[model samples]
Target: MSQSPHHKSFTARLRAHKIFGGIKPAVYKADALRSRVMPAPLPGNLVLPLLQHQGQPAMAVVEVGQAVLKYQVLAMGNGPLSVPVHAPTSGVITAIADSAVPGFGAQVQRCIHLQADGLDTAAELQPCLDYRALSHLQLLALIDAAGICGLGGAGFPTAEKLRVSIEQGVELLIINAAECEPYISADESLIRERADRVVSGAEILQSVCLAKRCVIAIEKDKADAIEALSTALQDSSIELLVLNSKFPTGGERQIIQAVTGFEVPRGLLPVDAGILVQNAGTAYAVHNAIVEGKPCISRITTLTGSPLQTPKNFEALIGTPVSFLFEMCGIDKSQHTGTIMGGSLMGIELDSDEVPLIKTTNCLLAKSTGEFPDPAPEQACIRCGYCADVCPARLLPQQLYAFSRSEDLDQLEEHGLADCIECGACAYVCPSHIPLVQYYRASKQAIAERDRQFQTSKQWQSRFQFHQYRLKKETTKALDKKLPGAEKTTANEPAQPFSRDQARDEIAAAVRRVAARHSNRTAPSSAKDKAKDKDRH
Candidate 1:
């Protein structure tokens, strides 16, 4: 039976649980949502980074000076955790060399530099007109070939996530349309412009995962988006879950809990909890891949900040440089203090404007000196418990901060440091201006490094034990050959490991045999000498 929008909305609200602990920050997304997503002009050059996704970097297939059409596979996914890289426009591969990774400071990774030609030629697409007729595996193959990933800033491969969802069996599929960040409105814009496509993509995902039910979770502030999605889903069974707009409400853990009234336990994923959450942008990409027969060559990114003359969303190609976007927006260079990728809480400040926008960039926020002034000097924690109150993961930020400062990894782990989402809620609420999230992030890295070192130590220990065993076995074999009357053991009899006392006994027995043999020879020589003397007489 098809559910009405009102019934589904009410049901979702009744079953929803309040997110553990979250803050409601001012949402600075009005300017970006003022206009529709504008198609960005093809740049003269594009720098496609290989390591845009989570896992291993993609391996380049095309060489320098090769002419490639749009949507051509330039680099293939190297490992299970990665997705392939596709050409955004028809261009010649000019160089494959190290380039600065966006958002990551001073880090360099391999990139495919392309010189775009005047013509934007595209390769032939193979769209599936009827996805229902195909098997689940076949649909997955198509999605993987298209190089789709979680466009929600995580960049997790979509096919890999769905494969796991299928294996584990998903009950609730949540399409996270909650753009709860302060300045980013990319997902909202995508849904507003292409809600039908997003719905179709959701249906396709439902079929793939065999989900029992699916829902699109959106915030109440996004009335236009909700209406668009509601109209598109009128004939569909997918539900619309309208939630209160709160900072970090769109977080995977928070959203899962909000929709299903179940919190994904610490140290486990949403799939472990029988829930699969995908970004609204990712679903749109899947629709393009399955129905339009298109590859993930471009995405909608929000370019908004106080330094720009006009802030708007752009449907940008994957490899366009940040400088070009700034130029298109008529951003004032003198007023621009820094460019941050993503939102204020979770976004990273890019060190250079030359950084190429990759698959995970949802927003590029150009800040002026007055807009995001330097944080006040960190003050001592007053222990007012405000940080703990705002932590959505229900973690005690005060304790975590102390443990982090002291490098008490065991204590941090016991207190649920791994579950900390680093949403910056604690820092935002801290009265002393302490950077609680920074401490938590550093502690997480320290824990990871410690774990890696411990694993290496275990490997060395295992190798040493094996080496010692080999030496002992060789020594035992040598003793067996040297010792006499040591009952020859048959192949079926396993060699008995010798104790220190047993080894001593074997050495003593060998000594006695040698002594006895010498005495017998001497006695025989004496007898021969006596017999010779008697014969002479």
Candidate 2:
């Protein structure tokens, strides 16, 4: 973690421009960083979820009992919004059923279960060392086929994002190495080992997006990672920026504002501000895809907590169960209920250790009862405005809190609730520990549901209107038909009338339909009554 001679001046330049409103909590990641990342052993069962990416769930291609090799496509999605799902190890598809896979927004989803045979086989891979020679569409297709997505917990499809940014003429690309969350060192450890790949990946992304400049934004406190990146980007034009370390500074909006001093307008994306932010791990994955001809099958995850024998990092494959890593560390988990997926502040607690790791799983914290106790019972908000003071989004969280509790979605949006990143900055600074993020999440979910219902109602209204229009057109055509030998019939002449039998049949059918409807409404599920009715008939 030696500093270059220019490190003093380089540090001062970034410090001169600082972001507003963030707290610096104690980062307990020293032990994890002390050791290099180790490859996690393949568990007995690997559960690959179909919907790992942001868009729709990829359709499963392999059926139960089918054999698959490492890096083979297990599922494929339709279009630009999704990436393919690949097998991590050579295995037989033992089951493909509804199941829980970790790293989603704290809920269970469908998964494809695989049983490894330990052979570690691979399918045929089309390696392209000359990505620069490929056309834009061809290159994007390659990235899509490789199943690449954002690893910074956003889980957005990388190819789709790059495609849109390129179309929109992105000006700046920012690579995030600012592992600002406490107890998370996956990105830092990855950079420490593979800084070259991260830089090269940034170059690829820059070319894909056609950005004017690429900058690697790291925290000033991470000296080792900074030094490593400095060496890697020395021969290149990419700039290494060292900013003050603070919670939520690693967020997309916050990082963009910190680096370029441009506040992304509310309800707009970072690309809307002429900037694109990507994670260091995502950059590394891109490099692996183009240069090494590898699909995204594994990610560097930080494994740390008090219950474990040692805290360290692991390059764990997707679908490795959380408890398997705990067992690998030889930990005593008797006192703990389950495990937390990410960091202490933003991570979700899982009641069962059976959850398997997916992309965006940066840490597996097996906290002891004493080390990671439950949040205290919610205390009443004191109306002290402390939450508003530390909000990085510059949002009035106090107002959002009241609107969310009251289920007032209209008021919530009017007061800028959507602008909140739920980065826990407000909750972190709350003196009453009100879990402000939870309230916002619930309110947003409610609003989304309401919007969905409204859209459905609109669709139904349109359908009804179309149906009425069709009926009117048919009725007019029938009325305007000329009668036989009446080519001289006047324009106001009456149309042909229904025959007597036709009218009788139509009335009888309507009567039968009404009678059937009434009978169904009054009928009870009794076999004896049905028999009695049949006998009476």
Candidate 3:
């Protein structure tokens, strides 16, 4: 929800979550938000990626050319970390193929292309007559079934997040309405039009959270949203905190520190700190899923930037192409060179406007000529410490930049590179114009690759250790095998684990396999060349 200083009485409580560090940049919301939100019909063919959320792509449940209804389950994912993908409207599945994803290049994701028949037919939905009547698990199951996720861009499955919060004994529920990013007002629009729904969703989440206190953390500049929510929660026990209008002030950790004066520890979630930060858009989505018995297939996306004749917010389908929004705004699709997702400071340039909207897509900015002029070539860092000063996570960007340049993971982690929110505060203030955020992104990806490999190896090592533990216990009994005539069908003998010597040998075999895999990847030279090198050596 948009936050403002309308509730002046709550200012004292708001001061508790003081602003930490952030940088201000040019905001382009005035022209963009001037035009109110309008519903954009789904494009000619909706291209829905099964991997809209933050886990494995949902497995397709329908075959090609099969007829489906609006809100019908196109794919299902029951994994703890995944959410299902649903059809946006009644259509036939035309193709399920790899397609280009927005914001990234050279990588293709599996997408379900649906050809709309204009039927607008919706599937039958089973609604919970009274949400209060359902148990917490039942509500979670409903949310999971609805494929609801963090609509504020993280795309983390909402059910899993709520379940984790409940499991971790989360105490405070901080509803994030910071909407601090410029030119992106989906949450603001939702709050302005449907603050009641947002509040109702918050109440439901609070019930599931079993939280002792609830806080709506929003920027004080959002006067309308603040007034709406102030009135909405007038008789409620929740606290309304109108925070400073700082860039990235709506960031998870920043808002957490701003509201509760608690800094989220590195490599840990906000829940670990006894807090659960959720987007206002997400809460509004939860309200829609449970109260309306609707599946998530559409969202409010800001289609702004200068390329279009008219820039405004559109309530578009989940898989509608960016070209559709451009056409809606009467802009030529070919001129979308700087089509970016999200706001200026943190937005990623789209390789093509054909990229379809996803649950996490909050904004689509197609810059017109000279809107975002090219930056000067990056110069060397001068150690001015300005990047450090503006860093919201308080990590040393210059140091991270140096380590990332050298591809040093140890120092990067030592300096807390993972904590950086990539809000571009450092890069914004840097005189060098260093793409520090990009470097950090690269570093994070690299570290993640290493962490994945390390985890696999650690699991094998754990298996080996467990085998050894069982082998020692096996010494007390002839657990490996019984003598031919001795103790037939003895039930008291302990169930033995894998043999330790065999386990050790298996581990050795695994090491060799891993080494061979790495060698095959890194050394693709011919056998002749290898022999020649060996002879030379």
What C-alpha lDDT do the candidate models reach, one value each?
A: 0.88, 0.84, 0.83
Best by lDDT: 1
Badly placed stretches (over 4 Å) of model 1 are 1-16, 103-106, 481-537
Candidate 1 scores a C-alpha RMSD against the true structure in Å of: 8.1
Provide TM-scores for the models.
0.87, 0.86, 0.82
Q: What are the per-residue Cα lDDT tens digits for candidate 2 across 235-292?
A: 9988888888888788898887677666677887777656778999999998888888
Local error of candidate 1 at residue 9 (angstroms)? 17
Ranking under lDDT, best-scoring first? 1, 2, 3
Question: Which 10 residues in a row give candidate 1 its minimum summed lDDT?
Answer: 1-10
- Cα error, residue 156 of model 1, in Å, equals 1.2
Residue 303 miss distance in model 1 (angstroms): 0.5
Choose 2 or 3, whichever is better by TM-score. Answer: 2
Per-residue CA lDDT of candidate 1, range 50-95, in tens?
8887777888999999999999999998877888999999989999
Error of 3 at 207 (Å): 1.1
The runs of at least 3 residues in candidate 3 whose Cα sits more than 4 Å from the true structure, single-residue gaps closed, are 1-16, 103-106, 332-335, 453-537
